[model samples]
Target: MSLLQTLPSLPSDAAYDLVVIGAGGAGLSAALHAAIDGAKVLVVERTAHVGGTTAWSAGTTWIPCTRHAKGVADEDSLERAARYLDRVVGDHADAALRRAFLAHGAEAVERFEQHSDVHYRPYALHPDYESDVDGSTLRGRALEPLPFDGRQLGALFGLLRPPIPEFTVLGGMMVDRTDINHLLSMGRSWPSLRHAVKIVARHAHDRLRHPRGTRLVMGNALVARLLHSLAQRPRVTLLMDTQMREIHVSDGHPGPGRSIEAVTLESAGTSRRIAVRGGLALASGGINRDPVWRERHLPGIPMDWCPGAPGHTGQAQALALQIGARHGQGAASPTFWAPVSRRQRADGSTAVFPHFVMDRAKPGMLTVNQAGRRYLNESMSYHRYGLAMQAEQCRSEAGEPGAAAALPSWIVCDAAALKRHGLGMVRPGGGGLAPFIADGYLRHGATLADLAHQLGMDAATLEATVATHNRHAEAGHDPDFQRGVTAYQRNIGDATWPGRNPNLGALTAGPYYAVQVVPGDIGAAVGLQTDDQARVLDAQGMPIGGLYAVGNDAQSIMGGTYPGPGITIGPGMVFGFLAARDAWRRCRSA
Candidate 1:
């Protein structure tokens, strides 16, 4: 019997007009919008729950020309946005594709807010990755989610993931840089007072009545709220622990009319195929967590930075490949890899690269290789960060006499830096930074040379680098490397400093500590190619009927560089909105 014949058929249920694969920030955004357009929607998630890696994200959505940019109306323009993108992505991006993102991104945000519970607060404060680039305004391009009550999620709370404890979640938390500084100040000013009391009180209340203990709210808090809105809708059906195995394609008569008839899914011990008369939207996230695929696609870098779901192994990508979908080629390998650090959870298992890297509450110190040499700019963009790590490894291999190999860099800080800038090394429930120091994970040394020896580096070289850096610190000018020069860098730097460079410091104090740093990735930037409408393209760059991808699973339209905080989610939502609109149009036309 054929595979279709061998499988028991599902009952003649109502054919879903739309099938969205992943439930991440991107996938859910697409599904909610499709449902709003009055399409019968079914969202399938591979994990036991939904929310994907977004639950752990900082929840900032970056968009240029947003309502927040109204004050600086004269500074930003569509042409400027285009120019900035051209400089960053270069010839890698198609002009049409870039135009699509810029033109539709604002509309998509407005549409999402109108149809769903995803309310956006215009943040006039966020910075662009490169503020100096044309169309790159200092503000008005980014908006973050307003805090929501997780208690509303109810029993569905267990179906969602919780934010890491190190992050504050009470009082509608915003994980931006300023919020972190507030958290730190609260801790220091009132040492005896509970720093996060409001958050804890709300969390405790939710735990008492809610089945999941705490309601989940995080990065793009509005996105999660929006998903909750859809879950409450009578029309939307969310299937947890279900995986889409393949898409059933119809070989239509030779024309621009071939389409998908249904999608086959595997759940529990049984398999069922759901007919897709309208269209199938693949928002299943990227291939950042799949070790096998990472080894194949991004062989050069370590898989450290991925904050995506464990099941986000490109199942949708694989399904597309099986359907003869053509893959796009550019750099032959992933230009960026998510860099993360290994943090041991309470259960003994390790959680890699929580939002601490981006959280202002905890400052991310500079990373040095095993040989105690600084390799890359600590404040560089994530894509550039990955490239720097890889370059460091290459330099180590060349062995130009006595070069230190860059295996994994160390995040060094003195007691003052630790106190001023929080370290993510605290125990799950325990307060204070004792555990990290008590355990060998965070090593403390009295002097620069002693710290170098402890980190297994050439003592003289490390001492000299520190001394030279100190001279720059004393003069309040970084000559060798401009550490706190850029807005992006200064945004993450120590705001308490009187000088312009917030990231600059002497590192002259005793009891210096070092936390080993690894290349932690947010997600893979490369994936299957798509058009401006989020349509999957074949080898000839033609749209594949009934197949569309958005978010990380789709090749980043911005090439490998991150223009702003929400660049990933912003486009993901925009393309997702476009795909839903196009799918509706296609279904209605048929």
Candidate 2:
């Protein structure tokens, strides 16, 4: 049964030991942690479904020194991870929070595995984004959620948010990194053929009974596990379609001694007041959609570019700010960014597909600015690529006569690359290009010159750029940007390619294609200041009693630097776990 139907109603006084706002990874983690500790917890979700942006993500978490990484990374330690963070994130955020995450990340993983339904396994090949940084490892720091059978969730399975349509295949079958590889090589290898056929058959069977595939993977699985654990906890109450209106503190003035007294919530067009006995954990994704916040921090980017769930309206952050909960300082960027391509779906909704590792870094592909010149390495992390776009756009906006803008940058690929690597929303194997071209989402040309003209760029410049790339590619090196020099870059490149460089190949084939990409804010980096224990802090750096923030609602421990896979989700879950324990401690003290 759905938790909403099974949960008992709140008492007449509407009192609870803890209240968690937002039902994303962090909020769910906080609520689950509290519930496992025997606290009466109430989880408020504005959206009908749980799992915020996390649900749409790849579901990788970068937690160093976890039990899952024991045999995989004997050299890994908190000190080594700290050094990498110091090199990449240095002074952009509180070091204490980083330390706290490093120290307790393993414990948090262990706790959830032992006491809840959540489970994870260390990735064998996932590498940190900043492999060039000191003390970085090629693997063992990243963990992915083990695929879960959504059938186990039964009716409650409907509560989990579905994966982005662009990320799925055959209507609604979710595929992980391994599945994609196996599916792509099914025709060549018998084992791969068996695996692909098995999954496809399973998904086909599921279509008859379930709305989507019952075999959940990635972020969907992570959320399903958390939801399953919460369902088993009788003390937990999950309220969907509930919006928090106001946060009532213990005083009229904002002070360090302030405590959460109650909160006003609106649900189904009715407003009600509820009492809080322990603490309030704010995990409402982030402020990415807030108009003022967007204008102030993410200028020049359209609000529609953000692929995160709509629940992150910043209402909770604004409410927290009203009580003097100032935003954390010194983040390298206000928001974590990714390059995304947009297409109009048949349902009239726009699909904002993030271009991470699927195409750009592969052989025979290249990214170019409006001037039709390569700006940054194509193999760089999505976060770094987005940052580069913003930098180039900023330079162009400064009115330099010939400065090229990176906004609306085009990723150009030859026919081989288009078929093997797939460009943006275009799937591999090159079967469905007509619809995308008709919709203006994909542009193709008989030659590089024709492609450039179609994209409204100077043909001569684009031809020259392609010639230069091909020259370097033939030599198996990209000296200009060093595309595949890093371990992380090479790992994502085509491993089966017989070329001199897996990430490089001559773009000389006919029928070149291009797709436009814009920088997208995947999550927030700047958020309410919080202490090491996840307590929200006042302007004076004093902890505000009974108030906590996690997920995107709290300043990221990475300081806006994407050091590795799952930086955001890893710290989010860790801090959420800490916030719940701290809240429970306060309850016992009271």
Cα RMSD for candidates in order: 4.5, 1.4
lDDT value for model 2: 0.90
- TM-score for all models, in order of appearance: 0.90, 0.98
Q: Give model 1's TM-score versus the native structure.
A: 0.90
Quantify all predictions' global Cα lDDT against the true fold.
0.68, 0.90
* Candidate topping lDDT: 2
lDDT of 2 by residue, 328-387 (tens): 989999989899999999999999999989998899989999999898899999999999
lDDT of 1 by residue, 367-460 (tens): 6777776666666655556666677777778876545666577777666666655544442222455666676666777887788888888889
Question: Residue 13's C-alpha lDDT in candidate 1?
Answer: 55
Error of 1 at 16 (Å): 1.3
Winning candidate number (TM-score): 2
